[model samples]
Target chain A: MNRYVKLVNFELGRFMKVYIALIGITIISQLAAVIVVSKSYLNNANQAMNVDHMAIETFIEQYGRMSFNDVTNSIFFIGPIALCIVTLLIYSLFIWYRDWFGKNTFIYRLLMLPTARLNVYLAKASAIFLFVLGLVGLQILLLPLERMILQWMVPIDLRWDLSINEMIRNFDRLGIMLPYSIAEFAIHYGIGFMAVIVLFTIIMFERCYRLKGILLGIGYGALALIVFFLPVFVQEFMLYNYFYPEELFMLMLVTGLLVTAGSIWMSNHLLTRKIRV
Target chain B: MIEVKDITKKFGRKQVLRGVTFTAAKGEITCLIGINGVGKTTILNAIMALTPINSGQILIDGAKINKKSYEKITFIPDAITMLPQMTIGQSMQFMQDFYESWNQERATELLGFFKLKPEEKISSLSKGNTAKVNLLLGLALDVDYLLMDEPFSGIDIFSREQIAEVFTSHLVEDRGVIITTHEINDIEHLIDQVILLDDGIVVKAFNSEEIRENEGKSVVDVMREVYQQ
Candidate 1:
């Protein structure tokens, strides 16, 4: 096997325990959310018929609907999703810091490996990508499972059935997460992965310089962010009459590639030159 | 031979190494002796390119150090560099994965020599055992040069004696070895050359036999003369 592939697998193994926990939490919570929402709708109907002394037809008329929105809006459903996002964000930083600040200094061993030092950076970035993809894929798979649970709990007439696409379009966060078309999906995730690469670069800068590098790293990150969005800002203000949508996308694509390449180059340099142990 | 030419390093405003220069030849043990905070470890780190030097060059066999040159040299740092979560066997496997020079038979033999179990977790090992494991990792590699930073620092006397024994054994026979220590009582007889460092400067560097024959001074006597002054 290639060394880079081995390194990526090694990096993945390091984060596997927490990644599995995140998946387990998301699955359990989403299922519980579907059941809880269903029971609430049933309980409301029963209360209206028995406690309020209303007729069955009237009770059905008052509270006779359960929708995907009902389940999605619940705390149980949103909580796990939010947790996964927050956990992944924190983990991105932890992944780098842990090698330096862990009980034993693992950075020494990593930096001294017999391969190009950049493999460490690439391996770590790949692990982060894999983790994000794993979560996004899990959430996509879970939607249908949650839908099935909803169907099983509520009667056919009381449920507002919707396909996975419809459910995604209806939710703001889900829409952003699972884009409608393959092109949109690629654009969104490609930009997201680029952002991750840039973040990893900044983290490397901090690792190399220690206390003094923190501000420098933040400045570098800010600069990269501004450069990435420069085309959009220019199109809005300066180039409003000049470029078409395709042209603007081309500009964005070129800028994204430049930033990604620059970040990877800088990361490799820091890993080789300035990193302290 | 490994040559370090006029290396200078500073952390913040504090200069740690100032124009430090030295060489370690094949089949010789070069001992860098200094009090604490005298750039002994920094020199070893610089040689291995473990840490960056502000200014200088380190050459191995007349060529600049690079990824491939690392195949010819190995550094065993004082601290346990292996992942604390991994067992000794796993750490060995990790080394075997990355290093072409890793010898599994030698590693297995060293494990027995050190009396360390393959299944022992690095975090769970005693301080002496952890140091032994660090030493074993470097010694088991088929490299021409070995750099060790304070290998005997803070270990038990028995463990130190065990480590001292490895120096005399065939495990270290044909390699150029650079070792740093403030505590040098145990391995005094094992060193071929002694470099005395004081305040980030090499006050004296001489072959052990040359100093003994010329001045009739033991390493300890010279250390007292340099440090006491």
Candidate 2:
């Protein structure tokens, strides 16, 4: 196997325990959300028909039927996803800092590895990407199971059925994570990957220069963002919306690639030449 | 041969190494003697390329250090570099996974020599044992050059003796070894060359045997004369 792949596997193994816990939390919370939301809706229906002595048709007219949309809106449903995202974002910085600040100076061993130092940086980025994708895949798999639980809890007449597609499309956050089209998914995640790479470069700067490097890292990150958005700035202000939407998108894509390449090159230089352990 | 030519380093406004120059030949043990905070460890770190030098060059066999230089030269820092949570076996396995130069046979032999258990977690080890494990990891690597920083610092007498025994053993034979230490009594006779560092420069570099034979002075006597002056 390639050393980079081995490094990725090693990085993943280090975080395996926390990653498993995140998956477990997402599963249990999302499933509980479906059951809880469905049961409460049923209780409301029973109260309307029996306690109020209202007809079933009158009760149905007054209260809308329950669907996966209700469960998706709850904290129990979105909270775990938010937790996973936050954990991963924190992990991006932790992955590098841990080697330096852990019980021992493992950064020494990492830098001493008989391979290009960039492999260490790239391997960490790959691990974070894998973790994010893995969680997204888990969410996709859990949706149908959650829907099944909802169907089992709420009676047929009292509930509105929605396919997995409808459930995801109805939830704005879920739609962002699991885009309907492959192109949108690629574009969304490509930008996400670029952000992560830039963040890693910033981390490299900090590691190289310590206190002064912190400001340098932040400055580099801001510069990258400005460069990435330059096309939109030019299109809106200087050209007065002269470029078509597709042309603007193309220009942004070029800028994004440029920034991503620049970050990687800078990180490589820092790792190989300027890094301190 | 490892040639460090007039290397200078600065930490903030403090200059740590000021045009330090020295060379250690293959099959010879070169001891860098300095008091506390005299850039002994810094020189070793420079040779391994762990820290960048501001000016001058370090060449291993006439070429500069690179990724491949790691396979040829390894540094055993004052402390173990493996994660404390890792067991001795897992730490060794990690080294094997990364370095093609890792010698499992020598590693196992060192484990027995140090009376260390593979199942033992690094965090659980005593200070002496941890140092032993650190030395074991570096000694097991089939590298031509080995740079050790303060190997005997803050260790028990027995552990120090056990570690000193490694120098005479085949594990270090034919390898270029550079060790930094303020306390030189234990291995005074073992080292072939001595580089005395003071205020970040090589005050004296000489063959130990020649100094003893010609000057009629022990390394300690020479140290007293040079430092007192």
Candidate 3:
């Protein structure tokens, strides 16, 4: 058991309660959205055929068959997912601040651990990444279950059934989360991980110098963002589209790695030499 | 030996430590005596590397403090460092999880010595009990050097006495201990050396036995003469 792994487990355990609640909320809210959307679609179908004296074919033609897309678009479904994203984003900051501002000063113990101080920084970033991935996995698992409930409620003739793949592709946000290809998934999440690392570095700056550190942190973050996007800036403006798409992508990848490495190096320096608890 | 040589620190415009220097041996108890806000705790923090000093060198056995220094030395701050939501047992477990120097046997003995239940949450402990637990955490570490900051600052008399008893016990014997406190009446005879700090510098530092034998002065009498001057 590496100390970093142990630290990650410890960090995860601290947030286990809130993590479980987020999972529970996502499951319950998404499931309820499916049911509510299905029942309402069915009620509209029955009213069109019986109350309006229209044929079943005519009713289907008018309302359009209900699919998982309707449920995905509802607030019940999107709200929970948004909440999870917002909570995790906030947790990324809260995780560090909590140790400092909690009931007791646990930062002292953390800084005093008999390992590289960067392990503490990296472990915290790992925990936040794990939480985000866990929620993404949960959403993937819940899609089929949600589809089953929708199938059970809506009549076969009046419903538009979609496979799990079709359902995800049709919804915009879900597609972003569960990308169509493995390469896109890797790219999306690699950038996400880089952002987290950069944010952790900013937090390190703030912890090191307090009020002055806050300004220093924000300035560092902005510099990192500009550095990461420099390739695109050069591609669009200075090069005048001189580079091919693949070349531009490669250039961006290089810059992203540079920024990520720079942030980690800076965070390590601050943690080991400049940090105060 | 722990040698803190000519360390200086500044908190913005306010200079807290000015060329402060001292040394504590492996088997001596060095007490840092200062009034409120006189950089006593700051010096202890500097020794532990909890806070960075602007200019100085602190060496434990002629080596700089690093990650491994934590295993050889530990600091018990004035306040508890564990989360309040953690139970006494969980806090001990956390210590075990991190520090290879954590001594569970000594920890358990300290628990009994302090009459603390493992199941008790830290948030629910009284001020005296909390101080005991804080001391227990540091004392249970099998390290050569221990830096304690204001161990008896705001505790009941009995708790203070119980904590004072730890100095004479085997838990601290043969180990270097640097403790900061303004009140010295309780452990006047226990400490081997005294470093008197005033306005961020060492005004006087001497062995208690030597001062008493040569000048017929208790630690208090020397303090009165220096402070009143």
Top lDDT: which candidate number? 2
Best by DockQ: 3
| DockQ of each candidate, alpha-carbon based | 0.77, 0.83, 0.85
Q: In candidate 1, what are the lDDT values of residues B13-116, reduced to their tens digit?
A: 99999888888899999999988898898888888777899998989999877888777898898898899999999999988988899999999999998889
TM-score of 1: 0.97
Give model 1's docking category.
medium
Candidate 2 lDDT, tens digit per residue, B121-201?
A: 999999999999999999999999999999999999999999999999999999999999999999998999999999989
Write the number of the candidate with greater TM-score, choosing between 1 and 2. 2
Ranking of candidates on TM-score, top first: 3, 2, 1
| Residue-level lDDT tens digits of model 1 in A84-202 | 88988898899888988856878888888888989888898889989988889999999999999889888886778999999999888888889999999998888988988999988
Deviating ranges (above 4 Å) for candidate 2: none
Backbone clash tally (model 1) = 0
Return the interface RMSD of the candidates, in order shown, one decimal each: 1.2, 1.0, 1.0
Model 3 CA deviation exceeding 4 Å by range? none
Task: Tell me how far the alpha carbon of residue B68 in candidate 2 is from the true structure, in angstroms, after superposition.
Answer: 1.2
Steric collisions counted per model: 0, 0, 0
